[model samples]
Structure formats: C-alpha cells, structure tokens
Target: MSKTTITANGQTKNLSLEPRRLLADVLREDFRLSGVHIGCAHGACGACTVHVDGVPRLSCLTFAVQCDGAEINTVESLGGDDAHHLLQRAFREEHGLQCGYCTPGFLMTMAPYVEEMAAQDRMPEDAEIRHAMSGNICRCTGYQSIVAAVRLAITQRRNGESTQ
Candidate 1:
C-alpha cells in the first residue's frame, strides 16, 4: 500500500491505498462522495470526471497514488452558501437531466467551461458548446435541454445575475 493524501471537497485525508486503486473508488469509498459515478470504468464515459488541482480529470482512469498530494473537488463542492450552483439551477429549469446519473459528471465538466466563457463575456455558438460537452455521454436527454441549460447559465452569468 502506498501512502497518499487527497483533499476532497475541502476535507483533507491521508490514506494508505493500493497502487492499482482507482481514484473513483477512493472518492466514493474513502471520502464517501457519491457524486463520482463510475459509468464505463473506461474513460469514454465522463461520469467519473472530477476537478483535480482545479482541472477536470477522469477519476476512473486515475490512480489514487498518482494523485499523492492533489486537491480534488467532486460535485458536492459545486455549490456555496447553501444554494445550487448556476449550472445546477439551469439544468433543473431546462431539464438537462432526467435519471440524474450523468448530471454530476456534466456539472463537473461544464462548470469551468461556463464560467470561462462567461468571464470572457463571450457567447459560444451552440456547436462550440456541443463540442465542449462531446466528451460526456448522456442517454436520457437528447442534448437539446443540456445545451439550453448551459446557455442559460452563460446568459445569467453574463448578465451579472445568479440563477438563485
């Protein structure tokens, strides 16, 4: 077992983990953060995406030991002040999620995208938005609502408004 430290959702823990243990397992089993879903176990499905050191990464494809002293953020960290994040509210209003299995991954993946675009004060074309989300696959929604949700968040942020 390799000694590893993972800071998840602002809580830091030191753990003894096997070299082969997937990060997804560590987050779910050790941290008890159920937001990281293991859909494909392969990297094809973005269901296990998490923010690793402030960047989106596939937790399922990563090793716990590899993350040694990395800071991680799961979907649980998405909100602050006891309210859903902008993207989350938009998703609910736009019906971006149905079964809710893939919602966490989508939120994790798009949070940066939406904020970056909003900060730039640039409105991405629908195709650009679709390309950014192409890494994730959701069998429930046809993606129209998903696209709409992202657009909504972008609009809200650009307008200096919160989805609250």
Candidate 2:
C-alpha cells in the first residue's frame, strides 16, 4: 500500500491505498463523495469530473497515486452545508438535469467557465457555452437546457445575486 495524501473538498486525509486505484474510487469509496458518479468509467462520459488543483479533470482516468499531494474539489464543495450554489440553483431553475447522472460532471466542468465569464461580467453566446461544454456529454436531453443554465448562472453571478 502506498501512503498518499489527498485534500478533498477542504478536508485533508492521508490514505494507504493500492497504487492502481482510480481517483474516482478513492473519492467515492474513501471520501464518501457519492456525487462522483462513474459513468462509462472510461473518461468519455465526464460523469466523474472533479477539480484537481483548481482545474477540472476526469477522476476515472486519473490514478490516486498520481495525485499524492493534489487538492481535489468534488461536487460537495460547491454549495454550503444547507444551501445550493448559484450554478446549482440555476440548473434547477432551468431544468438542466433530468436523470441527474451527468450533472456532477457538468457542474465541475462548467463551474470555472461560468465563474470566469461572471468575473468579466460578460454574457456568453450559446455557441461559446457549447464550446466550453463540449467535453462533457449529457445523454439525457438536448444541450439547450444545460446551455440555458450556464447562461442563467452567469447572469445571476454577474449581478451579484444569490439564489438562496
């Protein structure tokens, strides 16, 4: 067993795990982050996306040993203990999720994009949103609602409004 240290969602833990274990397994099974869904398990589905060192990456494709000292942010870090984040609220308002299997990936992948746009106070076109979200595949509905959610979140953030 390899002794690895991973800081997840603001909590740091030292673990002794197999060298070949996937980061998704460590996050879900060890960290108890159930939101890290395993869809496709080949990194194509994007259902296991999470932020490692402030960048979105496919957890399923990453080995836990590779992230020995990395800071990982899962979906749990988005909202407060009792409140939803702006993107999450926008998603719910716009009905961006149906089956919800792919929501976590989409959230992790798009959070930075939306935050960047909001920081610039820029409204993104659907094409730009589509381009940013191209890496994530949502098999449930068309991309319209997801795009709408991104737009809504951008707007809400730019205006400094909280959905709570």
Candidate 3:
C-alpha cells in the first residue's frame, strides 16, 4: 500500500491505499465520505466528480496514489455558516435538483466556470455554459432546472456576491 496525504474539505487526511485503488473507493471506504458517489465506474459519468487542486475530475478514473499532496473538495464542503454558496442557494430556490444524484457534480463543475464568467466579465454564453457542463449528465431533472440554477447564480454573482 502507498501512503497518501490529501487535504479534503480544508482538513488534512492521511490514508494507505493500493496504487491502483480508484479514488472513489478510497474516498468512500477509507474516508467514509459517501457523498462521493460512483456512477459509471468508467469516466463517462460525472457522478464521482470531485475537485482536485480546484479542478474537477472523475474520481472513479483517478488513482488514489495520484492524489498525494492534492487539495480536494467535494459538495460536502460547499456550504457554511458564513453563507451557502450562491449556487447552492440558487439550486434550492430554483429547484435545480430532482433525484439529486447529479447535483454535486454539477455544482463542482459549475463553480469554476462561474468564477471564469465573472472574471472575464462575460455572461457565460449558452454555448460556453453548455460546453463546460457537457461532461455531467442529469437523468432526473432534464437539465432545464440545472441550467436555470446556474444562470441564476451567475446573475447573483454579477451583482457582487461571492459564490465560492
């Protein structure tokens, strides 16, 4: 087993894992962070999405050993007493989730895109937003509400709110 240290949700954690162990397995089994679901064990589905060094990646396709020294964040870390991220609040207010299975991945992926949109002072054009979110698929909500929620969060962000 290889030893790996990762900062998850702002907390440092250490674990022993096989070099070939999938990140999804290590996260759910060793860390007991069941919120990181494994959907398509292949990389096709975004269900196992997580942020590694602030970039979204498919956890199922990533090796635990490869995550050594990485900073990871999951949807579990997306909210706080300081405030709910604008995306989280928008999702709730806009009813962005149906069964909610894909919500976490959507949030993880969109967070960065939203920041880019604000930084560029360009409202994410529909094509850009769609392309950015194409990797994640939602079976239950038909994607309408999800897109709406993202748009709502963008508006809130443009109005001077920090969603991250």
Overall lDDT per candidate, in order of appearance = 0.92, 0.91, 0.83
TM-scores of the candidates are 0.96, 0.94, 0.92
Best by TM-score: 1
Q: Model 3, residue 65: what's the lDDT?
A: 93
Alpha-carbon lDDT of model 2: 0.91
Candidate 3: tens digits of C-alpha lDDT, residues 75-105:
7887753328889898888898988888888
lDDT of 2 at 154: 90
Of models 2 and 3, which has the larger TM-score? 2
User: Residue 14's C-alpha lDDT in candidate 1?
Assistant: 95
Give the lowest summed-lDDT range of ten residues in model 2. 74-83
Winner on lDDT (2 vs 3): 2
Clashing pairs in 2: none
- Is 1 or 2 the stronger prediction by TM-score? 1
The residue-by-residue lDDT of candidate 2 on 30-94, one tens digit each, is: 99998898999886888999999999999999999899999999988898554298899888889
Model 1 lDDT tens row, 17-108: 98999999999999999888999999997999999999999999999999988999999898753438889999989999999898889989
* Pairs that collide, model 3: none
Candidate 3 off by > 4 Å:
80-83
Clash count, candidate 2: 0
Give the better candidate number (1 or 2) by lDDT: 1
Top candidate on lDDT is 1
TM-score of 3: 0.92
